[model samples]
Target: MDTIASLFSFITTPVSWIIVQFHKLYGAIFGPDTGWAWGLSIVSLVVVIRICLIPLFVKQIKSMRNMQALQPKMKAIQERYKNDRQRQSEEMMKLYKDTGTNPLSSCLPILAQSPFFFALYHVLSKIASGDTIGVLNQELVNSAREAHIFGAPIAAKFMDSEEKVAALSASLTDVRVVTAIMIVLMSASQFYTQRQLMQKNVDLTVKTPYMQQQKMLMYIFPLIFAVTGINFPVGVLVYWLTTNVWTMGQQMYVINQNPTPGSKAQDNYLQRLLKSVSSHGEVRGRRRRSVVQAIVAKGADRNDNERKFFAGLAKAGFAAQADGTVIKSDTVTADAEAGSAARRQQPKRQSKAQRQSGGTHQTGEAKPSLEKQQDTPPKPAGKSSPATPRQAKSGQRKGSQRPKHPSSKK
Candidate 1:
């Protein structure tokens, strides 16, 4: 009975079965010593999984856009009922109801991938630990154990996670450089994958506070992957790194063909990062100068002022683009307008909805005469005051002034 159950379990374990096939495939295709196959297999698997997650990723992006769109109305509700928590809750609910957006939709893809990520980790760990005999058939185990993919033991640094390596591995062999490179690439690529997804695929509208929150999460999430990448297996690292490269390519295709409103199709993080890295500290300084110049350019030809200001920076070899503003591209238009001296001098324009709401609340739109005030007569300027004892003593005059009534409007 135990043997039968074990056979059924063995048949179901995809990783174990795949590991068996990998050994045979490598042996048959490229001979016994050509060990690059394992890495390629891992990369292929990662790509397959990422492709499968595409729908989820698309859904996440759509939901996130909806969330961003709802943010302005939610903020208005928050402000309108700032002191009344109950009404604020009601208003918030109404806003969400109208917008059909949920704040949590942003995390759907990540949540869906959690189990697969853990499963992959476990599968890779098992193979790398040299305990494949039970997980895979004996023939497959023997063949796999002899395999040296990338000149390192397939199972060499499975749980090591660190490049420093264990004393046991050092006594047996040295693959620190390979393991370290793998780990770094894995971490860096994961960072790039997440960063690109957010900066490209996500239809993030920054007009709302919710979108800013998403932006903060984007950086925070990448930072997390960079920190946690150290703990994943090197094979897992390769998987991650490859998956990221795939995502970058996939997202690039999507963005290039159908870019988001605020995104630039012609440029990418690689260009910016490479420029920043190559220029030492000069890129950032130039960026600040260019922004200041662009702002100045909107009003005056501050070229002379900029020259004196940025003369010390000429040695840095990075200068503000001469026509980045003057030439006018979509990227530069918003920056030139808002960051400009002209915009600072000009008052902001109010929206039509705001004007209508303000008029309804405070203008003559709701004007009506007060019936009570209209009905009450003022004391005659030349007549004696009614409350005086002398005037009261003239009872006929006081009695005559007090009697009047009308039918209720209700």
Candidate 2:
């Protein structure tokens, strides 16, 4: 036990030094007397450690994706070697080696975090007893021992609640209550983050050994944390809770942007992208349809108006020929002498229903009708017409105005 303690102490020395440096930095900012400074220092230390482990977290994500990709082959190996356990293990190992994937890589982040967790636990526990460990002097340890996060000392534990209360001359109920709350938060955060990964990011259809292990851990790790959190110091709980929060946020980002191929998160991400694209396409299609409908309706209205104008002209004793030419009422009477020739030259006019319903006729007749109406000769200098009022006014202005010679300007 003594040899083990010495080895553990040696392993935890760097963690102690880091905490000491952070405590000094936070103490300078928040004042040495404030207990929350040391508590914040512990949290900052956790941030630094998690930041350093980002590459490992990325590796873990890649490994998980690789594992999901390999699920089919792993299942095949298992089915082929159901009666040969040794052979199955060998095949699985060979598969992992060939794929350059480590079944344990997903656990690397957690495994790496464990020693730091224990080290922080050790440092906090030793400092609480006023021990000079690593770079932490007696003064700093005393200040750390006195540190409180929400009235619970950084070194306080649920298991040692009574001892802490008595030692600080504080209320036993307050310490216990604070300690219980921290444990609950620590355990719950860890549980929630781990459960989120298992439920969302993992593909559940494959029954490989790795997937089975994940399934077991989905329940086991949380249970372990819930049971073990009672004995953890408040500072250690702070570190864990902070780390779990970081993990949850990081995992959520990964699940959204780079989900595992066969996972629910990936499916959801794909569905969202496809939905957005389809919705945009539908909107553009509707817009195009609406534009076409409006243009067709406008053209129909214009055709109807032109037909009414020409019919009015025919009723008032003028005639429009199929060649899009209009003959005056006086000329129509003169042309009556060649009625047989006129009838032979004129094309048959279809009924109003046919003219209105025939899209091609309406489109073909519109431009020609407009051109003939524009080319119609001015009225025989007698009556004013409502449609040509602007032209009549312009003609009167032209008759009244005379240009002066440039010599008059001098």
Candidate 3:
């Protein structure tokens, strides 16, 4: 630990300088030698560092999502070159390169913050040893040593001996108890952050090694923190705990706002969107508009959650447009439904006899009555009437009937 801290010695002066500045601001309210003064100084330092690392954290999130999306292609490459380890590695690197992804991007924030963490540890260790380092002169060092957080001196550790703890005007039991509680809180916060990420934000439809790796880390990270926390000074433990809590809150906000597609978070988000749009008759915010626009752009490619969102909108008598706006469509849908119903109606079924009779009843016209037909004049006898050509042809023999006619007359 000492060697690692020494490696970051270059940053100790700046870190101590920032801490002193924060201490000056806090020391006015809480005595100069109070735990609140030094403890909050460390916390302020963490906040500053984290604020600067926000860009890196965002990149890490993007990188992680990209990696998750590439799992299928990665798995195929692995299987294709399973017998050739070198070729498999080559292909994996090529894929990452082409995708503009860095596997190490997820570690960027941590790696960026490591120097300040170790530098603070070195600063606290120096105070515990009654030595002055960085901008922490002998006076500030003595003040820091006298600061006790929850009855444990700021520079004390869980593993510190009774004599060393007594040297800082604290009991071994107090230091151990405070550090143990802090370590547990730190580990729990870390575990919850990762667990929520895995449970609520991950694309559950895809089963990939990336998910398995994340699950492994979810357990592994907390265990690592629990093991290494004892060696951390009280002030360092406070730093870690504050940072863990900050990380948890930040992740919670991201999961709630812009969750991965096909995740539980997205489902919940879309449901809420459906309710809001139905109630307000519009997408309320720019962020929500962008979400709707992206979904609309996906068209048929939308995931289950997005499809359900569209269905809910239509059910509520709303239609989503290409511009991410909603409009009332109740009348249009109603007219379409009416037309379909009209088309679906069939004529009444007819019996075989009625169908064979030429279906005059289906024509919807009245037939003449029997009394009216009898009242009509019978023209055939009166006009015999002129034997029409058709009648003459019917009465005459087809051919050669003269001889037969003569015999009959005789």
Q: Which number leads on lDDT?
A: 3
What are the RMSD figures for all models against the true structure? Answer: 19.0, 25.2, 7.8
Give the winner by TM-score: 2 or 3: 3
Candidate 1 lDDT, tens digit per residue, 1-410?
22323434433366445544564565567764345666656655665567788898788667755664465576677777889999988877777777777777767766765555555566554455545534565445444445554555555553354443442233223445566677666556656665765666544443444656666776676567666665565555666667657756766666654434234432342244334533564334454345445534654443233344333233333334454322213444444556676767875565787575553433336434454447766778899775644445633654235434666452
What pairs collide in candidate 3?
A: none
The pairs that clash in candidate 1 are none
lDDT of 3 at 241: 95
lDDT of 2 by residue, 259-351 (tens): 665577766754553344334432124433342233234544433323443344434445544433334566654555477587888966777
Q: What lDDT does model 2 reach?
A: 0.71
Name the weakest run of 10 consecutive residues (lDDT summed) in model 3: 383-392
Writing each residue's lDDT as its tens digit, candidate 3 over 1-410 gives 98999999999999999999999999999999999999999999999999999999999889988987787798788788889999988898899899998887866877898999999999999999999999999999999999999999999999999999999999999999999999999999999999999999987556555677788889998999999999999999999999999999989998999887888999999999999998898999988989998999998888889999997887788888888888999875786678789889967887786776543576655556654767755666556534323323776755344345655856
Error of 1 at 354 (Å): 45
Taking all chains together, the TM-score of candidate 3 against the true structure is 0.82
